[model samples]
Structure formats: C-alpha cells, structure tokens
Target: MKNPVPLPAYLALCLLLLSGCAAAAGSPGSAGPPSSASSSVASPPGGAHAAHHGTETGSPAPAPAGPSEAARMVCGDQPMDRLTAILELKEKPHTVSNWADSTFTCTYHLAEGTLRISVQQAPDEASARKYFDAMQALAKDAKPIEGLANLGFPAYETADGSAVFQKDSFVLHVDASALPAVAGPNAITRNALAYQLSTTILACWVEHH
Candidate 1:
C-alpha cells in the first residue's frame, strides 16, 4: 500500500531545494582569497599535507615548520643504579650484572644543527650502574661546567659508586669527554642530551632489576 505524504512536509522540502538553487544563482562566489583556503576539510589543523581539491574550492593552509630536532626528544628512564654503573664503565665486559648490553642514543637540536649521540654497551645493569655512579660523583665535584648548572643532572647514589636521588628526580648530565658516541651543541646541550639518554638507560635498569 502506498502511504500518503503530508502536503506541508512535501511542500516545505521542495521549497528548501528551490531556495538553495535560487540563492546559489543570485549570490556572488563565496570562494575565499586565492592565496590559500585550506582545501581539505578533514585534515588536522596543522597537517603536513593538504586534502583533495577535486570537489573543493579552498586550498589548504600552510603546514607549520614545527619543533626542531631537540624539541622532538623527551626525558626518559635511567635511574640510580643504572646511572652509576654506566658512568663508571665498571667491570668492562661484565657491567653491573643488573641489565643487558644494548645501544643507547641521545640527540640535541641547536641553531647550529642537530647533535646525535649513541652509546653501546655489552654488560649487565649492576656493572653499568656502578660506572654511572662514579661519573655522577665526578660531575658533582667537577667545576660548575659553566652553563650546565641550570640543567641540574645531579650526582645520585653515593656509596659503592651508586647514584642516589634526593627526590625522585631521574636525570643525568654528561660531557662528550664523559660519554663517548654522544654529540651535543655544547656541554649544556650535551648535558640535556645526556638527560634524555639517561631516561632510556633507567628504563633498561628497571627492566633488569
């Protein structure tokens, strides 16, 4: 059976369609300025690329340059025990015996360029933790190192060359002379770089210990 449609409803729908056609015909083009108009409606605000323009009238906005290399990295894991052993380079082949041998990396971005640092080891956590502790002590007694005091990648876990944290702070600062295969803008940049690397180390320590 065919259902009868309400007259008002049908008429209103027809009027809306007719109105839209009339409006388009009478109105000037709504297209924006020619410079750029964000073509893709679905793209993110700062998307790297613009969307399809096949059916569109707008162009995509420019993508932001965004953060540099240094800005991309964040602080990560290395903790007390891991810090000590790695810094000290204790037990060479053996390491702290608390973690496994692996590769670690740190990167820094400066107006000059990006500094990438990589540290490779073949030892257990306990040994690496020991080395890390010794290095922390040296960094403490070592001169202010000029601009690096701001970083505050302090010495942790004292005795047994173990790094201790006054608070739960998990950071480490080092110089190129301090750790091989790590590159940074300057000592400060390196310190920041070290801090990032330390986080990774700390993660390894946590897994093993």
Candidate 2:
C-alpha cells in the first residue's frame, strides 16, 4: 500500500489528539501500538478476505477509519466534533491529517477563518511548559493566560491570535487566522476559548485515567 500523506503541522496536531482519544477509549484498531498516518487512512476493513497463508491476496480491505478507540471514549469518533459543538460553529469538521497513535488534528471551516486544534502527549508538565516557553517569542502582545498553571499547567496567549497550554501529560494549542464571533474581541475571546478547550480535554483525560 502507498504511504499516507503527511498532514500539515497544524492539522497533524488535531489528528494526534484524535488518535490519543481513540487509545484512551479502548478502541481495538488503535490499541496495540501507535499507528502511522498511512495506517490510519489505509486501514483494511474487519472482514477482509484472507488468502492462503494469511496473506492479503486481493486488493487491500477498507478499514472503517475514524478516531482511535481511545478518542471515542472521551469525544466519540472525532474530537473536533466536540470542539465544533462548543464553538457553536456552522461548518462541518474534517480531519486534515494524523500520525501513528501520537496525535490527531482537524479543521473547522468558519466564516472568520480556519480554526485548527491540535492535541499531543507530553512526557511531563515541565516538558510541556518548556515547549510553551520556547514558542512565546511569537506572541505579538504576549500575555500570560490565567487559571491554567494553577492547575499544574502553564499557558499563554499571543496578540497574534494563538493560545497554548499544558495539562498533566497533554498539550493543547489553538490558532485562529481570523476572529470568529464566538471568540469575541481581541485576545480575550481566543484565550478564553483555548482555556475552555484545554480544560475540557484535560477533564476527559482525567476521566479515562
């Protein structure tokens, strides 16, 4: 089978989160190990006919692709769906790309602009903070986001329209190219939305554990 196309960095992040959601939910397809982007898209169906010697003799079977079992446990087959519902978006959500079990990302088409949500695993709280710190330079009107580090996760928002935060063993990042009505004015809306999404995701992660 051909290798699956790698998703853009922003989209890839959403995919990673979706995959983690799948694993957390105990979905069988994504259970054993991290699945690559190719495996995610090219998965064979459950009832694929087998050739002698257990070889896939005919065309590859089509696997029912969606979020990993882990993702479903918290946010159903698509984590973005939960986000869209929260954002009260009118456009449909679609997966941009993903990596082997590590991350999942999706884009929500809106009149304002594309909104991307990425979720990834972090080794520790410190590691996630370090990563966030490094990206701080990009903040145009950088301001510390409140109520996150107090919970053991440090967070920040940039004037340029981005929000980042870490929680437990996961990091959440959000980028908005254009302002959505739901996000409100200035960074307030964007940061608030980021806070909401990160907290919700953290809650789900906690529930799974």
The candidate scoring highest on TM-score is 2
State how far residue 4 of model 2 sits from its true place (Å). 42
Q: Which segments of model 1 are wrong by more than 4 Å?
A: 1-109, 112-122, 137-209
RMSD of each: 30.2, 14.5
Task: Quantify how close model 1 is to the true structure by its C-alpha RMSD in Å.
Answer: 30.2
lDDT of 2 by residue, 1-209 (tens): 01122224324444355445533443323433323232221111221111111223434323324344433332234345556655665665543444433334444455566665554433334444444555554456767765423244577666555666666434466666365534522223554455445545554555455
Off by over 4 Å in 2: 1-82, 100-104, 123-125, 148-150, 181-188
* Per-candidate local distance difference test: 0.27, 0.45
TM-scores, in order shown? 0.23, 0.52
Candidate 1 residue-wise lDDT, 1-209, digit = tens: 01133334433433343322211110111111111121111111222121112223355322213211111121122222223333442322211111101222333322334333333221222323443444444543342222322223333322111122111212232223333333322223234334333333333332322
Clashes of 1: 43
The stretch of ten residues in a row with the least summed lDDT in candidate 2 is 43-52
Which candidate should be chosen as best, given lDDT against the real structure?
2
